[model samples]
Target chain A: MAALILAHHQTSPAERLKDAAAVAFIALLLGIPMIGLLTVDQGGALRIATRWPALFAFVAACFVGRLVLRYALDQWRARQLARDQADTPAKEVSLATNPLLNWIGWVALGVSVALPIVFAENRYVVDTATTVLIYVMLGWGLNVVVGLAGLLDLGYVAFYAVGAYTYGLLSTQFGWGFWSALPVAGAITASFGVLLGWPTLRLRGDYLAIVTLGFGEIIRIILVNWTELSGGPNGIASIPRPSFFGLPFKPPGDDPTFASFFGLEYATHQRIVFLYYLILVLALLTNLFVSRMRRLPIGRAWEAMREDEIACKAMGINARNVKLSAFAIGAMLGGFAGVFFAARQGFISPESFTFSESAIILAIVVLGGMGSQLGVVLASLVLVLLPELGRDFAEYRMLLFGAAMILIMIWKPGGILSHREPTLRYFANGGRR
Target chain B: MTAPAPLLSVEHLTMRFGGLLAIDDLSLDVAARKITGVIGPNGAGKTTFFNCLTGFYKPTIGSVRLNHPQRGVLRLEALASHQVARSAQVVRTFQNIRLFPQMTVLENLIVAQHNALQHASRFSLAGLLGLPAYRRAEAAAMAKAVGWLERLKLIEKADTPAGALPYGMQRRIEIARALCVDPLLLCLDEPAAGLNPRESAELNELLKHLSRDEGIAILLIEHDMSVVMNVSDHLCVLNYGRKIAEGTPAQIQKDPNVIKAYLGEEDADEMRADELRADEAIDQEAVR
Candidate 1:
């Protein structure tokens, strides 16, 4: 959906038509294979070809179509601007102040939150929404470091893994509850954050990124190799699910479970509703924390360091301390999300916390505007939910996903929303009572 | 006023970049509440001296002391740039304007006051939970930023990006940022390099007020002779990485070495002839 929006905003009628035609032609070419994949038996060569061919063909066509459309549009906009009267100054279209748009955006956000509760009958949709919320939390956490602090952290998932394992090991071994273990997990991950920051604080840009990537991989490797502690590839299972103050999410009898206590029927939809609300609270907490930090002195220091390290140093800001704090805080948020993930899934595996997971989180941050809380949430929702929604278009899903990201980036290099340039503003009346 | 101890005292400062001696045995004192101009021909180690004083470059040999009566003495030589700025109350502007380009004009001032901002709210978990104190501090910082912008006549362009301003306006913005730090000593490296006549005059007035009214000491490096002579309370001239002369502006102007360095004998004679013709033209204009 974001990709289609970007395509419409960025391309002219003629170029869009050309792209549409190319997509249609490729669809026709791959129609037979797609049909075979849907209808054929498992063990046939046709099935094998059908499984991969349409994906490959769709990817190739989208790649070619995007390049051609971009080139054509660039030429057209250049010509149109040039042909306009030279004496007339180009009109500056400012998007800074639009109260109506801002109100609408807030309203839309409220509706998105209330939708899951309203439509609790659909299990798949609720699950998808839950997944989107998790990504939103991850994106917000990464945004604090990457966007606000201007630190590129390729190893952010290491903290997430640490959080998961911390909760998983503590709760299972000690028979501790989820809420009790969550803080412990977060604190442990934050300690690792400071440890990671200790050596790498002085590094900047690409060097910092490389070091973080190594850190992420090291955490994953430790999980994989430490069989005694982590249970190796067999991952921890039967992890305890979160209950509302010791009430299990089952139907009540003489043993009062969550559903019976709440006077609800035994429906999976009730559990989904509970989880959705839990994740929503967590995501909101993450956003609230990051937004408040940004308004604080430490947050301002982080932004100052991002803008110019030398100037920051010259202004008496301890760059090392500022960076470490940013890392620790961002990691703490990641840890919180990780604890939530572990509790929500009742199972843990090294496969869940891979380098690819880190990449996807980072991609969400980039696709959203860096340093923008709202943009991160929106980007994560679109990126994570779209792939699930497009599952029926399975063979072409990832291809279209990649193409969409490229198109969005081309249209808005600063991300989908770039209006939030850092600033200091004063109220007209001094010191409001 | 009794001659107070130098606000900033440099003793035997020396810096070397490998084999090249950028600054050699350079020593100078910046008096309190006075403008001291460091003037020199090209490659006279003027900028290097500033760098060493500000802790940007650690000198191979030197002790730089800031004698603040209230704050006690500080050894600037061993501290990092940020530490020097905070403890010694010494702030500096770059030879080239280093305003945070993507930031707003107001944000640039607020960033300069970053350390001074209250962190009590930020330190507590309540801040992370969006306490009212954090919002109050932000509003205060913004208000202070606007005040500084208005003083520098940049209030109209307060919301515009810093990098989008014209060159002269940017230079003024840099000065405004430095002032926002409320430093005891301000080091300006060629602040008049790119200013037009009107802008230069405005800068001259600002510098005078900074010294006279604000009681802030200024250490200036300027290539423009008019600005240096017009504004400086005392002048220190450097040649070949050494102080050739130090005196009042009038005394330094008459010094033979200063004359010889700035103008060769042939050039001096030609300038003398031009001066005579300028005097005659002025007299004729006065008569008419």
Candidate 2:
């Protein structure tokens, strides 16, 4: 039925005008109150002023915009239809199964690896790329919970904050280095994940989302109020940077710095480059680990639970354990990202871990087809770079992001790449066994 | 009749939802390696009874004991839902098909054998490392899935998502998925609900084969009289959450209470009126 509509539906010029006029009508109704009328205070009394010309302009723009958008969409669809016919019936191929996507993934890896080297001196490029990688890593983590296990986790930033604070307190109070505190932070964050998951075990869908949102707020409030341990709202500064094994990337000193040990010139970009590579390796490892997990029994159980919890139970899968494991593993990965975040920034604050950060991380997971590993990378790039590039727009920066999100939702509601690859496959030649 | 030992014995099982009594004082014995058909009209508490047995609902006052060969008498009601399938090896399919819609048919079967593979995977450490033992376990699971898919004639559609298939095929896939658990007692709730005549016939053959050749006892809850009469070794009829009749197929068909329960009291009253008129005619003929 949908295919029939797609094949035959063509708008005449009059029909296009009608569609745009409808949009214009709605715009007039909405814009009259919101944009046309403005309240101005004159000597303690408010008087309403009408901007009829501005409203007319706004409505006209809406009409024209809708017509152009519709025309462009129709052209794109026509091209897609033509290409689809020319193609081999367009099989349902996922990113994991498609050879082209596989190659793209490999190329992406190559580009990421060569990026730091290609732009060794350009701090801004490497730094932005690193930021993108951080989101990619966080997206992959949240995917385990939201994508695979079907848990709506709104407080994921809580785990990230826990990890950051864990590293911050451990290093500042106990004088622990990044290497020593990384695993400890992860474990602490995982426990925090469990702490958050335990109560929400019976909850699902919107209720679960609400509870996790509260949990995120609770962690932030604690960090803000607790002055002794967390340094209150001031946060902990001077958090140590991760070293190259034992060699710190420092200026010339008695002790062997990374530059001195390598007999290279001391440069601050060395640390930035190291940080870039550190996150790069960390993100890659996270990808490898998560992808490997998808093929494992536990991972399959998570997916099964996500698909149907009642059926999972009937099939003898303990849903509680599956859900909790998803939370713990997801939190652990988020925690690892947090440790890197703290190390890279050399400062920690509750202000950095906010609800919007959680939303962005989640958006990356969702916008990149939920379970598609490569999707996360693509989405992170678009999400992070769009804002960076939109810096020129200043006030309209966020507006651009919102518009892109809305466009993606309209175009691909399931996701950019929604096909899921089977975790296991059978062959005609007595496969596996 | 010399019946085999009972595999699952329900002693006065009762279930109540709020003020409504769904199942009342229902006692039944499902024999080992035999198909026991539970037939009733809509809302006869047949599904409610299955829910009680499968640990979906806690029976208000009764014991559902599964006599496992190796594990002794296991109290199914005492165990959690998953444990009922895991340890007790008592698996069930839903009246409304509950196969994982997004998962492939093969993946659905593999998920059924999760416990065995999970244990072999050693907390996923072995699976992550792709160890030989875990690989072998996974291979075995795949082989088992393949075997069931082949048996159910779903091998060709193994890669297809379970939900995308036709309803009759989905029902078969659900049974095949349940079979992957290697269940000792398979409880099927309305397995033949949406089946056509040909499909129901195929289901009859499958149920017989399961009970006789595979030696897995089945507790079938079906509304299809042809299926229940054709394949069931013993039939138990339920009415208003109470057992109306229990016997072999032949006996169950002739049982008066069973007929009354099924066709309603009006039919039984009409049946009595016919008998009385026949008696009056016989008396007049004798006098002549």
User: What are the interface RMSDs of all the models?
Assistant: 2.5, 1.9
Candidate 1 Cα errors over 4 Å, as ranges: A1-71, A79-96, A251-255, A393-395, A421-424, A427-433, B120-143, B254-288
Worst 10 residues of 1 chain A by lDDT: A424-433
lDDT of each: 0.81, 0.90
Residue A323, candidate 1: alpha-carbon lDDT: 91
**Two-chain DockQ for model 1:** 0.47
Best by lDDT: 2
Stretches of candidate 2 above 4 Å error?
A1-19, A29-52, A68-96, A428-433, B1-4, B269-288
Weakest 10 consecutive residues of candidate 2 chain B by summed lDDT: B274-283
